[model samples]
Target: MKMLKMLSVVFLSAMIFTACNDDNTTNGKGKASIYITDAPIDDDNVAAVIISVNSVEANGPEGWETIDEFEEPVDIDLLSYQNGEAFLLTENEMDAGTYSEVRLILNIQEKVNDQIQNEGSYIEYLDGSKEPLFVPSGGQSGYKAKGEFTIPVGGVVGVTLDFDVRKAVVKAGNSGNFILKPTIRLIANQDAAMINGHFEPDNLDSAGYNKVVAFAYENDTFTESETNEPAEGEIRFPNAVTSSVIIGGDFTLAFMKSGTYDLYFASYDENGGYVELIGSYQDVTLEAGTKLELDLELNLLN
Candidate 1:
């Protein structure tokens, strides 16, 4: 896939706020800044992966508050924010307390006639292939993420929402249309780790399966016999940093929290299709500010 570079445009308003404080005991409110980042997907044919984000909402003791709202739906090409790079979505002063949920409201759009119009969020490929990216029922309510994080009085809290495109876009049966089943995770910028490696497929052609997907399951076990069962642990799909395939068949999965994780890989085809399970490494431990490297020879399922 051809890599493209795009500059981020921040839509800031004239709202004055106090600097974020690191200590929680400070008087009133703290600053919370949210960012948008992507975990790399292994699809070579896609030229752009665009999504429309309307607003960001956070739930605190004061019920729900709009942290950031876009006057118009902002179309973001996620492919540009790979490998730890991120764009600021919104920033606002929030109360100094534990915020339980953060939600993103997406505006799905479509192409009508020759002009690109807002019907809903959709994906367009380099081959001129297009698909409808549908957000499920709950997404309309908001893509709600649960976690208890404190905005220290005067201290700034940075949250990065990782959008894993590979896991989020699902093909609708034999039809060419796709569904945007968004798979997202929240990572505090300060507590993230990395995992890198090389994937060597014995007989697969590089062009056919151009993308590599790494799935991280925290505190989980995956036995070959239990492949059909839903395993436990937080599954950080393709959105983890270093999750995209690099030149020379190398892959990296970054922004992982410190824990014991089971890492699995799979081959992704040109048409946004997952070929098969490449292989997996169990009991992989990650620590803060540490990088784990593991090169693997993929085991073909068939």
Candidate 2:
């Protein structure tokens, strides 16, 4: 598998592909509907995270199984799939059984005139500026989505890979080049859950703080790394499974695997950097199809 330097992101530019060979099929076939979505990013400058995926594959007992491949590279805007929204890749029958991992392959590095050319994976800023995201090369685990799923004998199994774009994307040192890391959660759609709610502060507004990023971490897993300044190639809330920007007195953390979590709100300082943890919601249990709606209040930090 290709290693991402630090974190990773998801931009599944999905297209229909033919199924695997008959040798990989079993006595019974099952259906799989794969989708991709992204967690909210706090970077206000980021307007669109466009990614181009050439194919989707799974690791099976028979070996690397092909789920689907694209005849044409599709440019998918990950930012559009926020707030629990998902983009379906394909819904086709496959070998019945369990697969340990799922990954997305980016064919951006194409040889044109015997030269490596990056196709259409880049980030668009609010100011109309753009920069291409550097996609690394390697095995089927290029995107690094981790999970275990079983395609039933005669039923459909739907899974959504939550790409935490905020974490997966980091600038390469002082080079200004953004690298797309492989950091994603492969969650069974039936067991995936989300946390969404309104948090209108009594005396706080967007202008009060530079930024308010809501993070969801496994219960009691939050450490100082979450609030402290991140390393040169990392971001705060490093331990958070997922996070979202608190906008218009509303925020959402979506596609979390079923579990107990601690939701914390951190307000950035004047420099637009993490300063302190201002608000929190502890011991929250979430399940699929159910949204944990929280009515929260923000406290002054500055």
Candidate 3:
């Protein structure tokens, strides 16, 4: 009878020990989040940059198993700021395991069709949502996080991705006579290797209806054709004509390693009877990752 009692006591102690260990270890999961701010941006209305986290997994014996098993929140927001100011929040707990890869997707949601009617024409493309944009590359498909990162179990980490508004544009819908131009905005990263610029066409179109007006604005001020003078720029409003439209070279800019920059393009006559404002911007990393082109358009009703 004494021997039987001792066996029962040993089994009960083992069960208690197992429960304690399970409580101490992390369930295996982490969190990620980020946003953008308009630093020294002249405009009051600023767009928000969105961040997304997905495809979280480990590189251990189990392979790339989803962390769906964890019950905690996977995304965290540290804080937010107005204009040049911003804040961030970090997740207090992270999976206590070593991870091989963590994939993240970034994008911006802007209201399309917002327009200011100039002259008698309704020359505006406003009110719609842009497709999801991938960072490091302005692709319809979200870009991938390059190098590998590891998350310590139950530890917290915060990451910030700064995007300049200078490189964003609004694309208008078709179904109109004249093709309207896009409004331009510029955003620059101090360490960014590329900058955006624009130029005006030197000649008219095949229809011989060459009433084109181009302007390059800096810091909300307009200037004449100064393509080769100081800031070096070029442009071709009616880029492609029905029978034949001249092709102007690309508008590329070499930027300072670290500093602020801004530039934009607006055209009076695009093609046929259309007024267009097309602008191309991109999210540039210090390394030459990828260049994104935002082709925004608008049409005027005469």
Candidate 4:
């Protein structure tokens, strides 16, 4: 009789443990993962690479928010090219709740050697400051996601940030010193389709920094003529938007109506001007119920 009782007790304990685990993983509960991908968007002969998000969460509500802080220090090695990619697992999972905001936080890169690095290259600042901005050297860093979005449980949330590295320019603060990159996080909310990334620039030198310019062909003949060759020429029929400069981090035009359009960008330094042909006159058909993300990079020779 004693032996039988002992056996029964052991069986009950095992069953209890198993049930608890199942409750954590299933039953409308558990955590998600934020996957990162490094790819380049091509333009003309230049290819600019950027790291964007491709993450998923389980049993998540239509939306979620990042706590705005990291639970612990995340080690980011900025030296090796491979270090450009990173991921952090949340300490606690988002409980099974109706969340509407999806948030994320990115910590600064951990220092490897005495010297700091940004964009995998050595930097020089205006005030003779050793470290420059827009590269990972070390220090506190991060950016909040734009607005809220709705995400369903067991669903995948996809986001891609297309940037022109060669033509993309970042302005440093008044100090004009320090190495860092833009850190970002996202939150979920109702009508999540209205999210956008804000681009702001700081002035450091009187000579000025690089900027992107927006241009479109004047008439049907000009646009069709340059369909294959992305080149610069005089505008024959200038739309109300004759031209605009691409300065700071944001240099994109929203296309409510899309067709074939020729686009180009230029850079101006004290040395003079360098023209960059971003894309040829291609027929870009923008239809309803679609999000068009066409970011291109170009080389500007001074």
Q: Quick one: best lDDT, which candidate?
A: 2
The Cα error of candidate 4 at residue 238, in Å, is 20
Give one digit per residue, the lDDT tens place, for model 4 in 1-302: 00101112211121111112455546554333332211111122222222221222322343333422443543322211111122233323345444433333333223457554223222332344332234342232222223232222333222222121222223345645433233322322111111011223442123245544444332343433332332232221223112334445443332122234444333444332433443332333433222334433322211
RMSD of 1: 8.3
C-alpha TM-score for every candidate: 0.70, 0.83, 0.27, 0.34
Per-model C-alpha lDDT, please? 0.63, 0.72, 0.27, 0.30
> lDDT tens string, model 3, 192-284?
233322222332333233332222222323233332222212133212100011135133332223222233333333333324433322222
Q: State residue 12's C-alpha deviation in candidate 4, in Å.
A: 44
Over the stretch 1-302, how does candidate 1's per-residue lDDT look in tens digits? 11212211121111122354445345577878887777665556777788888888998878888898889877788888765567778877777777887898878643346554455566777878777675554235777666666676776777777777756666666545566664677766556566665655533454366666666666554445433422322132422323556446566566566788776766666565656667666777776555666665555221
Model 2: per-residue Cα lDDT over 1-302, one tens digit each: 11112111221122112354444454577778889889876576789998888788888667678888879866788999987778887676677888888888874543456665765788899889988787566222467687998777666677788878888888888867788887888887666666766766534574377667788889999876667667798887877898887777787777677779988878876545666788777888876545567666654221
Candidates 1 and 2 compared: the better one by TM-score is 2
Order of candidate numbers by lDDT, starting with the best: 2, 1, 4, 3
lDDT comparing candidate 2 with the true structure: 0.72
Better of 3 and 4 by lDDT: 4
Candidate 1 displacement at residue 285 in angstroms:
1.6
Model 2 alpha-carbon drift over 4 Å, by segment? 1-27, 109-115, 138-141, 201-203, 269-272, 299-302
